[model samples]
Target chain A: MASQHTRTVFFISDGTGITAETFGNAILAQFEFKPRHVRLPFIDTVDKAHQVVRQVNHVAEVEGRRPVVFTTLVNVEILQVIEDGCRGMLLDMFGTFVRPLEIELGMKSNHRVGRFSDVSKSKEYHDRIEAINFSLVHDDGQSNRDLDEADVILVGVSRSGKTPTSLYLAMQHGLKAANYPLIPEDFERQQLPSALVPHRKKIFGLTIQPERLSEIRNERRPNSRYASLDNCRMEVAEAEAMMRRAGIRWLSTTTKSIEEIATTILQEIRPERLEY
Target chain B: MASQHTRTVFFISDGTGITAETFGNAILAQFEFKPRHVRLPFIDTVDKAHQVVRQVNHVAEVEGRRPVVFTTLVNVEILQVIEDGCRGMLLDMFGTFVRPLEIELGMKSNHRVGRFSDVSKSKEYHDRIEAINFSLVHDDGQSNRDLDEADVILVGVSRSGKTPTSLYLAMQHGLKAANYPLIPEDFERQQLPSALVPHRKKIFGLTIQPERLSEIRNERRPNSRYASLDNCRMEVAEAEAMMRRAGIRWLSTTTKSIEEIATTILQEIRPERLEY
Candidate 1:
């Protein structure tokens, strides 16, 4: 339990620091320790790098232990400034991998500061922005104006996590996702919504445990009939039955993260749509 | 332009493959070659690993070039299967760093298959879901009920990238962000919206180039006055003048991605709120 002592961890980058954080957190998860995280992003200049080095050294001195610093700086001078000055152990996320890649590819790295500026002008970026706008307009079956345009349409009862999944699909994967809540009316009719009938080929369903459903609904409408366990059970059962009769693919969201749910949906509906 | 010949790049992982894709993309950005990406996620077992190796080897054989593979499998058996069997260049993302980390920390990694399940149950995940719901309700000045509870309020003209920036802040950072559009009413009055005046300290502004704004608006309402360059110029000038007179911090979103915009907003309004 010696590693139980909380240590300071820095995820620093010349850009948004997102890559450093993602890679650093994955490595840190293996250890048995608590991390006091400090994120220093947009450190694209040597002056900024020097400032960060001072901060890291000050923290290392105060903690009486070497902090762990994960950096994704591509600039040689800025990287050196932090590497030489910081008292903490530096885990160079980019430096560790870029050298081998450069050798393998027989090319030199552009070593650009803030790479997203170029990405923002890409066709993929435009598609992602368009997908986000599409999802926003189609959220909660708000507007069925362009149902055919959706790459996938999600159906679930209230509080079944359809909205977040749809938005995450759009935001992360650049897929146009529209979500429709399976209300009592649809259950009574035992059919898909009128607007969604033509798009049954792209329809996916999500069901959650009745207990969890009630718990979530309770947060929005406490002690109401809509939040009652019986109501949730009936809704889920009805929704599942409708999906089964329609031969639509579905999964339970009670135990999955948003990313997991979105990935599963992609795997089932459009395996080819998976992208970085 | 020999490097222009597209090469296959595989980002394989035992979990969602998000880490592998993120890190792989960052490294790949440094190179000059165009990659034909293949993401094989949820490759948990030895059988899945073998299956992936076959596909990668097949691609290598067909392409007559060694494909580059990036992996984040934590299981020793599965990782060994990949590293030993694949004919392509294998980059073990976990193995490359975990050993040094284990030496530094003096502990073995748990080597769990899927890491996000635990994270999904954490309080941070719940807060993220709540923040998403909060951002949804507070989007576009739809609801002002919880204005005081927000960490930041983004104000911008329509199509100025307020909603996506607010949602990204909520989704990535677990921060409650509300965004409101600055309409002609506020511009004519030369005053901040009465609903937002009380929360002045938490307000940030985003402005886009008049030309870019018109282009975006044209996508929605082509050939309308709202999409005219002159109208856009007037509105942007008015909004900027109002923000300057009110002493509110602002930035131009003309050249920034959602991540860049969100990170900049956090850096300006709540520097202490940055997280992994």
Candidate 2:
């Protein structure tokens, strides 16, 4: 956000411009000023770079302020066009980091463009997609046919956010996440599900504040025992005890987001499973 | 990668160091430098900031180079500590973006920390989770019970990478993506499945090079007609013809990654759906 004066900022990249905008905004979000961002992607040529500079200068003129430009162009010739043409501050992401990195590694960079996060044709990419499919198919313990196939299995009472948390692990972390919803029947048995028994080492647990669980459940089903605080409290207490008895590690989701829960679980269970 | 001279870099943040690392790496990718990155997260208090500075300064002295810092600290006092104590270039995401944004927006920023990209309790966050769930249930045209509920339905020959593409859409863009595998039987019929007929407008088609499809299929079902190049070629050709006749938009997955394919489809179909 621009404090008293709203200014335009451009995220210019030679490829997707995703890196420029994503990283640039990381810095921008800390600002008091609000920005009107214009993204210019696929600026792979000098002509395209020149065109972007013209537009950037126009924004600066109209706004009566120099617009900030965050660029990730690896091609120095094109980057020079922006540096020379644009009246605003040109923060060259590559230039700032490349020289220092080259000195550190004692070798020249490959000078590749848009190679950091390409996912179309790599084994790692394929593995992540496969992991995501695994999470979806095994969700809510719907099928035990492949319970032994999971990297981490999550168990929690209903409305404790097992599904979303597992999906986060699969989507963001590339981990095979399978979640099981604990019901009264499980409580009655006072034992882990038969299918989960063989894979106890991979199990993780989620618990939530009973009051929050009630509110979340009430959104889906109101005035029912399932959504009742008393029922939630009893279920949560039993579920926690169940996890403890099984020696499965557990975390409370009462005040945490899916990201936090997934990250903590991954850190404690399998550190190398996380991609970024 | 820091080239010859390996140096230590720190991603300093008041909350999770995710933004700093993600964006920092994007810039660092252009260089040949192999950086030794150390993340310092949850530096919320002044005391924590002081401790981090000591560690950062230690790294600088040990390495005998000015360590590069990518910081997302919103607290000016903490930021000042790093600027004054650390011997490095401080890449302040907030410092660079905030003042201009403040002037542009004509309002002082709330000076809050860890506000951007909070996923735990937002409606958009919940929407993404719901979308992921919808994609799993509606996958492979498994059910027509809620075909009309989907934002987009992906149709493709098996092994053409339909499942992963749809899931990426659901996970990244909050699209309720449903995919249906087009089989040889459907190719012979030269029409869409009965379930997809009424909602033809929501369909997007994916086709891959037969050779690539054959290789992918080979991995799934070895030495079978399903994995045959001839079968893959025939199915892909017929699938393309059917999609053309049905007036549906389509793209080739031969040279594109899932991100490119999904992003292009979204751009042509629903450009407004993407957040960045």
Best by DockQ: 1
Once fitted onto the true fold, the runs of candidate 1 whose alpha carbons sit more than 4 angstroms away are A1-5, B1-5, B118-120
Mind giving the per-residue lDDT tens digits that candidate 1 earns over B192-239? 999999999999999999998998899899999999999999999999
Model 2 DockQ reads 0.31
Give per-model CA RMSD.
Answer: 2.2, 4.3
Against the hidden true structure, what lDDT does model 2 obtain? 0.78
The model with the greatest TM-score is 1
TM-score of chain B of each: 0.96, 0.86
**lDDT tens string, model 1, A100-180?**
888888888888666576643688887888998899899999999988999999999988999889989999889999999
Q: For model 2, how does the per-residue alpha-carbon lDDT over B125-225 read when each residue is reduced to its tens digit?
A: 67776787788778887888888888899999886778777877877678999999888778778889888998888889999889888887887789889
Which regions of candidate 2 are displaced past 4 Å? A1-10, A31-40, A45-69, A77-92, A99-110, A116-121, A145-149, A222-224, A273-276, B1-10, B33-69, B76-111, B115-121, B274-276
Score every model by TM-score: 0.96, 0.83
Query: In angstroms, how far off is A275's CA in candidate 1?
Result: 6.0
